[model samples]
Target: MEAHLLPCKISSDGMHVDVQAGFVREETDSISFSGHSVQKANFRGRPIFGTKLPIPPPYEAVLAHPTDSLGDKEPARLFVKSKVSSITLWNLSDEPKASDKIPSAMLWLKLAPLIHSDVTYSN
Candidate 1:
């Protein structure tokens, strides 16, 4: 089976939409209007789960929504590392031009609440 990467923009706790990213999940074979079937997708070179991959050929980009409409309507809780440049968040509702400079207050509002009152969040 062929693997596909759908380009999408994701919002972080820091109130912005990030482009230049893609999503690769363990999806099934292409399903037609009449029928569908399941097949194994073995992506060569590297694993797509729990990691990031650069956008590939064919240039497929789907609007990325942070909401988990499949089961829970609540938005996801993302824990990001410090100084990750490749991932960008673009929240047009707040930040009109995400490519522009990010206001300090806006940046703090997005990232502050997600943090714990401790030294680090991970073990």
Candidate 2:
């Protein structure tokens, strides 16, 4: 899915650099920008939501690594986990300000294409 990326980082054994992260958002009947989770909130409770979290594309999409990540599961998953993971004091300067509505850039992430049996390593 396509997303506007907040200022963040991406690393791949030094093969890649200057990456940003953005939460996947979708226009939905349930929520709005900076919105609460759809499954957690009700229309009655928050009729004017901001960006609503999307259901992760598919089970396979959530599990498999992007082809660019060499289909390496942990690294790809870690890249994703970093989006929600808190930033360090060192990283805070690079992060998007909480007041910024639009992100610094956009990125496209492929849907996951693997299953548990396909993973060669695990945390």
Candidate 3:
């Protein structure tokens, strides 16, 4: 899959939109950063806080779409549009914490290798 750094944020909830014409508008200049460096933005009058997190080494986020079946004998296929090394996690109430679901999952991705490694510890 071709690698592409997507400038997108993952949200906890979903929205109903009819068209993609006015879904997103450029508000980068209005973006504010807190003392902790958490990026904040206003979307449709709602405040959202976000932080960019890496996808950990050797892993990437793939953006794909399922294609229609070619025939009954063939299995379904996915067309990978692009891949990203990092993604922004956005929260409606507050900044994303390690305790949050998505953040915790990402943390696990980084910790799983260490936890499963064959390394030995000595005092």
Candidate 4:
């Protein structure tokens, strides 16, 4: 997957800008992967590091967009653009680690089911 890690955040809602040509393609073109775990890229002169994590079973990463044409009383619709079993979590200062907040949260997700399951020991 081609992804870029931008340093700044945009605080606007529903604002569309053409980033494919100016940002994504450019940054992705320069991305370099180390072994199978780490990815490196430069965005606007700042280095970026990323690690790929597989979304555990029964879960996936979805890319969706709001569908146009909504009436005043009609519910909003979304169009699914793509889906993936894993995601590349990017960090500006360092390679993403399992100890990071998001990764830790994913770990909790994996453990929650087991923790809450009803198990009987036959002794």
Best by TM-score: 4
Q: After superposition, how far is residue 30 of candidate 1 from its true place, in Å?
A: 29
The whole-model lDDT of each prediction reads 0.32, 0.29, 0.62, 0.65
Best by lDDT: 4
What is the lDDT, from 0 to 100, of the residue 39 in candidate 2?
20
Write model 3 residue lDDT over 15-84, tens digit each, in one string: 7654336434232333323213566666567776676666767677888878998999997799987776
The superposed Cα distance between candidate 1 and the true structure at residue 50, in angstroms, equals: 35
Native-vs-model 2 lDDT?
A: 0.29
TM-score, cand. 3 vs. native: 0.61
Question: TM-score rank, highest first?
Answer: 4, 3, 2, 1
Runs with alpha carbons beyond 4 Å of true place in candidate 4 = 1-35, 68-75
Q: Runs in model 1 with CA error above 4 Å?
A: 1-95, 102-104, 119-123
Report the lDDT tens digits of candidate 2 across residue range 6-119.
Answer: 223544584744333322223345432224322221222332223323333332222223334445464433334222221111112222222443311111212234432365
Candidate order (lDDT): 4, 3, 1, 2
lDDT score, candidate 2, position 74: 46
Model 3 CA lDDT for position 55? 70
Displacement of residue 52 (Cα, Å) in model 2 is 5.9
Tens-digit lDDT track for model 4 on 8-105? 68576768877555443123323323224566666577777776666777776677778865898887798888875556677886766668777788
